[model samples]
Target: MRFSVHSVSLWLCAIPFLSLVGAQQYVLHHLFDHTNFFDEFSFFSEPDPTRGVQRYVSAFEANAVDLAGFANDAVFLGVDYTTPGPWRRSVRVTSNTAYDSGLFIADIAHMPTSSCGVWPAFWMFGPQWPYDGEIDIIEGVNTQDKNKVTLHTGPGCSITNEGTVASTTLKETNCNAGDAYLGCTQATASNDNYGDGFNDIGGGVYAIQWTDEHISVWFFPRGRIPDNVESDSPDPSAWGPALARFNGGEECHLPDHFKKQSLVFNIALCGEWAGRVWGDNAECSALAPTCDEWVADNPDAFAEAYWLINSVRIFQAHEA
Candidate 1:
């Protein structure tokens, strides 16, 4: 019943070794929630990097303007719909730490709806723009019903849609960021995968697995999230085909293109993509002469634009 001091020390030493073994089978590295989300992320206050008709606010300003806060035990990232603007106020937060490869899972209850002039995204990007890499896990603009998963990288990077679902269309193969910024994109046909439809059913879980060979994204609407993911033993191989899968193939290299990437989330109004395509959308163009004018004048239209996130979990692959 009584163990010697040396024996106890030996057992304590073994504890760490045993834990290391367990950690080798995929362990949860980070858990981001309302309480610690701020500590892990920093609000961006610079001009809209993409020249969108939106102003990124500081943490102090976000709290003051009610753009970012905790509501119902969930972290809320919202845009100011009350303020008409040359500058529409919104929050853009970037993770303080960067990761090379991991399984990133986000449990979202709500996201900004797909409305005219509104472009919202949850993405990851490395420094130096296209040369490093950018992965748009969830991105869409201006009345789009489904999500667009894309990647932007320097030349020599290309992807193939070998493992994606049939309904998903590969828009481009080259991941290079040319003058148009069209990157390799995949369009999902699922009505409930993004925007108003996603929010209507209550937002769901989006999981991104980044590895040396390829990057894959999967979406699980509300009650459909896999048990393996819920339990932290995520096995992407068992998740069926991804909604979007970008394989480096021979022309591109994953490790060379994708470097340390920081997770980012933001909402913008009427810039390059949305503004350029505004005229093509009959419904949106009917509302106003242009995207900027409509967004500036119709503040009340975006009252429902906000993100309600439950948590984000990052897991690293381990070998058992």
Candidate 2:
């Protein structure tokens, strides 16, 4: 896969400013292969013994989702069970505030993700998307042509991207960063975008390296990663070429604008992003190509919809 080298430097040259902190220096939880503990799966879950309303988690507020309406909060996602759904679930780690220099890695082994209306995302966000900010480290709609890695901020922020059927990278800046939130497509993989290509070959790792000057990212399959490149702030010296790049110099006005972002792992079925793909699934059930249909037609692939999360770990490098 020969990514456009011309596109890379072009993105690098466009960014007037950057935050290259390089490698995290401390550990917050060091969550990798832990079995159990308080901070281990610290994101609250439904308490046992009680089986009714008490099993609901009313803390987090979802826009259209009603807390008590579903089977239980645990149905959404809880550490009690091996999976996060009555039928299926993905661990969505969220941070009220974003992290500055640490690195986050979600080792997701996806199932048949090529089906329609099944939008699974391993990404992060600020308090208010486009308002606080949204970093879609790895997100692709149901169609899967462009595996998009974008940064969303209000006005003041804008970006430029470059890539083809192989990969993409972007440099961004939030100049005015208006009151309302906005987003920009930072990096993407053209051929390897996000579709049959990624799922077919095998799900890979998506990384975001945010610094004071720039944010660089790379994706690697579990099998492709070398032994030395295992840690966060991976030795990019061995990193494959970045797929996309966006410039933020003239656009980004706030320096600490993208400070803290929480980790979120979710399999949002036919919602905003995915809804756009197959259509408003909920609104247009008959027309919308929902996963339910796939489950019936292609049971084998639909089984993969059960996203397999091997592990989600974060690592920080010591300062020089």
Candidate 3:
């Protein structure tokens, strides 16, 4: 996206004039405000690739079901709650353009709650599945109280969570093609980071900084967002330790694994993750014999299945 010099000048004037030494400054590259959200993104009108019990609809269908619209100055993405569907109706949107490296920040007021058969995510992926890599930034499945951040790449790519917080646990170490399906996952300890606990606290901001050296994720509750973020000059160095960090040096090369990836946001129902673990979840398992059965029968259970996004901003590293 090309920004006029006037826009850049305005941003520079809004923030401090000087740049920090030994630190990188990110400039506002793309600002996806609620007003032009639908126009900026394209609806993914196809079957769920994961074979989930979901039917992705077009923008027109989403409008008809009141699934996608602006609510209270924020963008609302929701699923069909009242309709009795053999496959639940939902919406998936992909950004018009792709990015290589940048600081991606999402200001959310509410996200899909951790229900019995819901799988929601705000993630990114390349055209090539494992070859180009995928990043699951804010993702989790059924009845999960905490957020699970993961990375999926082709053969030879791996990461080490050496700089992550103590509360974050590494579920797997090798991020190769074998592990790509499941990938290298790190689960955040805070319940407030995702699901029902997150919504109860009025939601917050999730920032992801991707560079050649490392990929890091940080979560800030509603009132605790960094001042620099609001000023459009985010400095990840001052954000303390990230909740999850993937430092890829000699073990894996980032440019080889990650490429031009389009930003995506969607809520899938009873798919690979949610359906596979259905019987294990006592609360969810008690509702039906299978995940698909429960989702088809109880449509009202997903009344809280929606995303209330205030904004999504992308920042590119300012050249020195």
Q: Please provide, for model 3 over 199-218, each residue's C-alpha lDDT reduced to its tens digit, 9 standing for 90 to 100.
A: 99989999999999988999
Worst 10 residues of 1 by lDDT: 1-10
Ranking by TM-score: 3, 1, 2
How far off is residue 220 in model 3, in Å? 0.4
| Residue 92 displacement in candidate 1 (angstroms) | 0.5
Model 3's TM-score against the true structure: 0.92
Per-residue lDDT of 190 in model 3? 98
Ranking of candidates on lDDT, top first:
3, 1, 2
Give one digit per residue, the lDDT tens place, for model 2 in 100-196: 6555555544432545655656566565555555666666655565566666666566654432114344433342333432255544545443556
lDDT of 1 at 280: 96
Off by over 4 Å in 2: 1-29, 34-91, 95-98, 160-182, 190-196, 231-233, 237-240, 279-302
Query: Where does the lowest 10-residue lDDT sum fall in candidate 3?
Result: 1-10
- On a 0 to 100 scale, what is the lDDT of residue 171 in model 3? 89
- Comparison by TM-score, 1 against 3, better one: 3
